[model samples]
Target: MIVLGVESSCDETGLALYDTQHGLLSHALYSQVAMHEEYGGVVPELASRDHIRRAIPLLQQALADAKLAPQDIDAIAYTQGPGLAGALLVGSSVACSLGLALDKPVLGIHHLEGHLLSPLLAKEPPEFPFIALLVSGGHTQLMRVDGVGQYTLLGETLDDAAGEAFDKSAKLLGLGYPGGPAISRLAEFGDPLAYKLPRPMLHSKDFNFSFSGLKTAVLTVVKNHEEKVIANICEQDKANIARGFVDAIVDVLTAKCVNALKHTGLKRLVIAGGVGANSQLRASLNEAAAKKRFKVYYPELEFCTDNGAMIAFAGAMRLQINPDAAQRDYSFNVRPRWPLDEIKVV
Candidate 1:
C-alpha cells in the first residue's frame, strides 16, 4: 500500500509517500527554524501559516521524487494531535481534504507514535519488545514497547524535559532560540573537567527523570559567575557551562537507561525524538551499550526530527498490522493534547 504522510506538528512542514512494498519513496521537509529564530522561538500563528503554504508544494515534491501521481496513493495519514493546535489543524485538514478528493482512507496518527517508530525505518532496525526512550520537544519518556501500539510507560520527567532543559540552559548562556544544537556545538570546545554540575535524581531508585533542577543549577552557575566577575560570562566559561550541563544530562540519561534495561531485562534500546540526535548522548549511550553488551538503535539523521517520513512510515505500519485501523470518514478533528498510552489497539 502507498500511504502519504503529512506532518505539521510544529515548525516543520513535511510531506512524504511511503510504499509498504518499497519502503519510503520520498520525503520533502521545510523547517521554519530560520524564520522563527528571528523571534527567538516558534510563533504558533506563523507556523500554522507556513504549513499552509508549504504543504502542497512539498506534496508535489514528494510525488515527483517518488515518480507517482496523487491517484497512486492508497491512503492519507497525518499527525493529529499532541502539538500546536493550529499547526496540527493545517496538516489534518490537508490530509483529510486529500483523502476526500482521492476517495481514500485517512488515519489520525499520534505525533509521538511517529517519533516512537521512526527508528524502524533504519537499515538496521531493532526487533519487537524493546525499550524506547522518547525525548522530543516537550517530552522525555521511557517506555517498554512490546510491539506496535503496545507501550507501557516506565517513567517520564517530573518537570522540564531534556530538550527543554537544553534550550533553557542555552538561553541562560545567552544562546539563540532552539538552543539544544547551539549548546551542544559549543560543548565541543569545552574542557570536561573545568566545572562540575549536579546530576539531579541521577541515583533515584525509579526510572523517573528530573531536569528542572539541573536547569536551575545552570542558572545558578551563570548568575554566580556574572555576579563575581562583574561582566558577562566569557566564551570559555559558556563552553565550560555547556559541557558541564551536557555531561550531567548525559550521565543521568545513560544511568537511567542502563537501569531500565536491567530492570526490564531487555537488551535492545531504541532512542527516538529530536534529542536523540544529540552527539553527546549518542556517544554516551554507544559506550554504555558496548560495555553493557546490548543493542541501541536510532533513526537516520534526516528522520531524527519532526518529519513526514516517520509519520508516513508509522501510518503504513499501523495499516499493515490492522487494515481497519483507517476509516472512510473525511470529517476529522485534531487533538493537541493526546497521550501515547491512550492509543488502543486498532
Candidate 2:
C-alpha cells in the first residue's frame, strides 16, 4: 500500500509518500525556524498560516518526486493531536480533503506515536519491548513499547519539557530562539563542573522528571553574571555554563531512562524527538549504553524531528492490521490530544 503522510504539528510542514514495498519514496520539509526566530518563539497564528501555504505545494512536490499521482496513494495519514491547534487543523483539513477527493482511507495518527516509531524507519531498528525516550520541544517522556500502538508511559516531565527549557533558557542567555543546537555547540568547549547546575529529580525513585528547577537554576546563573558579582562570563565560562546545563539535563534524562529500563526489564533503548539531535545527549547516552551493554537505536537525523515518513509508516502499519480501517468516503475528525496507551492495534 502507498501512504501519503502530512505533518504540521508545530513549526514544521512536512509531506512524504511511503510505499510498503519500496519504502519512503519521497519526503519534503519546510522549517519555520527562521520565521519564529525574530519572535524568539513560535507565533501560533503565523505558524498556522505558513502551514496553509506550504502544505499543498509540499504535498505535490512529494508526490511528483515519488513519481506517482494522488490516486496512487492508498491512504492519507496526518498528525491529529498534541500540537498547536491551528497548525494541526491545517494538515488535518488538507489531509481529509485530499483523502475524500482521492477516495483513500484517512487515518488520524497521534503525533507522539509518529515520534516514537521514527526509529524503526532507520537502517538499524530496535525489536519489540524496548524503552523510548521522547524528548521534544513540548514534551519529555519515557515509554515502554511492546509494539506499534502498544505503549506504556513510564515517566514524563512534571514541569517544562526538556527542549522547551533549552530554548527558553537559551533565550535568557541571548543565545537566540531554537537554541538547543547552538547551546549544545557552545557546551562542547565548557567544563561540566564549572557551573554545577542542579539536576532536578535525578534521584527520584519513580520515572517522573522535573526540569522547572533546572530552568530556575539557569536563571540564577545568568542573574548572577549580570550583577558583576561573578564578573562577565568569559567565552569559556559561557561554554562551561552551557556544558553544565546540558549535562544536568542529560543526567536527569539518562537516569530516568536507566530506571525505566530496570523497571520494564527492557534491554534495548530507542531515542526519538528533536532533542535526540543533541550531540552531547547522544554521546552521553551512547557511552552509557556501551558500559551497560544495552543496545540503543536512533532515527536518522532527518527523522529525529517532526516529519511525514514516520506518519506514513505508522499509517501503513495501522492499515495492515485492519484493512477495513481504510474506508475514506467520509471525513474524520483530528485529535488534538490522545493517550498512546489508549490506542490498540491488532
Candidate 3:
C-alpha cells in the first residue's frame, strides 16, 4: 500500500509518501523556524497560513520525487492532534481534501504515535517489546512499546519538558530561538565543572521526570551570578551556563533511561522525538547502553523532528497490522490535545 502522510502540527509543513513494499519513497518539508525566529517563538496564525501555502507544493514535490500521481496513493494519513488547533486544522483540511479527491481511505494519526514509531523506518529497526524515550518539543516521556499502537506509559515530566527547559534556559542565556541546538552548540566550549546546575528528580526512585526546577536553576544562576551583569555576561560565561544546563539535563535523562531499562528488563531502547537529536543525550545514552550491554536505537537525524515520513510510515504499519483502521469518510475533526495512551488498541 502507498500512504501519503501530512504533518503540520506545528511550524513544519511536511508531506511524504511511504510504500508498504518499498519503504519511504519521498518526503518534503519546509520548517518555519526562520519565519518565527524574529518573534522568538511560533505564531499560530502565521504557522497556519504558511502551512496552507506550503502543503500543496510540498505534496507535489513529494509526489514528483516518488514518480507517482495522486491516484497512485492508496491511502492518506495526517497528524490529527496534540498540537496547535489552527495548525492541526490546516493539515487535516489538506489531507481530507486530498483523500476526497482521490477517493482513498483517510486515517487520523496521533502526532506522538508518529514520533514513537518513527525508528521503525530505520534501516536496522529494533523489534517489539522495547523501551521508548520520546523527547519531543512539549513532551518528555518514557514508554514500554510492545508493538504498533501497543504503548504503555512508563513515565513523563510533571511540568516543563526537556525541550522546554532547553528553550527557556537558552533564552536566559541570550541564545536565539529553537534553543536546544543553539545551547548545545555553545555548551561544547564550556567547562563542565564551571557551573553545576541541579538535576531535578534525579533520584526520585520513580520513572517520572521534572525539568521545571532545572530551568529555574538556570534562571537563578543567571540572576544571582556574582560576575558581570545579565547583559554583560561574557560569551564564555553563557557557554558555561549552557554546558551546566545541558549536562544536568543529560545526566538526569540518561540516569532515568538507564533505571527504566533496569526496571523493565528490556534490553532494547528506542529514542524518538525532536530532543532525541541532542548530541549530548545521544552520547550519554550510547555510553550507558554500551556499559550496560543493552541496545539504543534512534531515527535518522531528519526523522527526529516533526515530519510527514513518520506519519506515513506509521499509517502504513497500522494498515498492515489492521486494514480496517482506515476510513473512507473524508469528514474529520482536528485534535489539539490528544493523549498517547488514549489510542491504545482494545
Candidate 4:
C-alpha cells in the first residue's frame, strides 16, 4: 500500500510517501527554526502560517521524489493532535482534502504514537514487548510496548519534560532558541567536575521523571555566579554549567530507563523523539545496554523529530494490522492534547 503522511504538529511542515512493500519512498521536511529563532520561541500564528506555505510544496516534492501520482496513493495519514491547534488543522485539512480528491482512505494518527513507532523505521528494529522512552521538547515518557497500540505507560514527566528543561536551562546560560543542541555542543568543552547539579527524583521508587527542579537548580547556579545578566557570565562558566546540567539530566534519565527496563524485565529498549538524538544520552544508554547485556534501538536521525514519514509509517502499520482502521470519512478533527495510551486498537 502507498500511504502519504502529513505532519504539521508544530514548527515543522513535513510530507512523505511510504510504500508498504518498499519502505519509505520519499520524505521532505521544512523546519521553522530559523524563523522562530528570532523570537526565541515559536509563535503559534507564525508557525501555522508557515505550515500553510510549506505543506503543499513539500507534498509535491515528496511525490516527485517518489515518482508517484496523487491517485497512486492508497491512503492519507496526518498528525491529528498534540500540537498547535492551528498547525494541526493545516495538515489535517490538507490530508482530508487530498483523500477526498483521490477517493482514498484517511486516517488520523496520534502524534506521540508516530514518535513511539518510529524506531521500526530503523534498519535493525526492536521487536515487540520492548521498553520505549519517548523524550522530546514537549514530552518525556517511558512505556512498555507489547506491540503496536499496546502501550503501558511506565512513567512520564510531572512538569517540564527533559527537552524543555534543556531549553530552559540553555536560555538561562544565554543560549538562543532551540537550546537543546546549543547546550549539548557547549557541554563538550565543559569539565564534568566543574560543578555538581541536582538529579531530581533519580532515586524515586517509581519510573516517573521530574526535570523542573533540575532546571531551577540551573537558575540558582546562574544567579550565584556573580553575573548580573547572562551577558556578564564568562564562556567557560556557561560551558561548565551546561555540562553540569546535561550530566544531571542524563543521569536521571538513564537511571529511570534502567529501572523501567528492570521492572518490566524487557531487554529491548527503544528510544524515540528528539532528545533521543542526544549524543551523551546515547552514549550513556549504549554503555548501560552493554553492561546489562540488553539491546537498544533508535530511529534514524532524520526520523527523530516530528516528520511525515513516521506518521505515514505508523498509519501503514495500523492499516496492515487492521485494514478497517482507515475510513473514507473526509471529515476530521484534531486533538492538540491527545494522550498516547488513550489510543485504542481497531
Query: Which segments of candidate 1 are over 4 A away from where they belong?
Result: 226-231
Q: Write the residue-wise lDDT of candidate 4 on 161-246 in tens digits.
A: 99999899998888999999999999999999999999999999998899999999999988887866879988998999999999
Winner by lDDT: 3
Lowest lDDT sum, 10 consecutive residues, model 3, at 223-232
Candidate 3, 45-98: lDDT as tens digits: 999999999999999999999999999999999999989999999999999999
lDDT of 1 by residue, 104-181 (tens): 999999999999999999999999999999999799999999988999999999999999999989888888899999
What does candidate 2's lDDT look like per residue over 126-188, in tens digits? 899899999988889999888877888888888899998898778766789889888899899
Question: Quick one: ranking by lDDT, best first?
Answer: 3, 1, 4, 2
Candidate 2 steric clashes: 1
**Model 1 lDDT at residue 197:** 93
Clashes of each: 1, 1, 0, 1
**Residue-pair clash count for candidate 4:** 1
- The CA lDDT of each predicted structure is 0.93, 0.87, 0.94, 0.93
Name every residue pair that clashes in candidate 2: 82-336
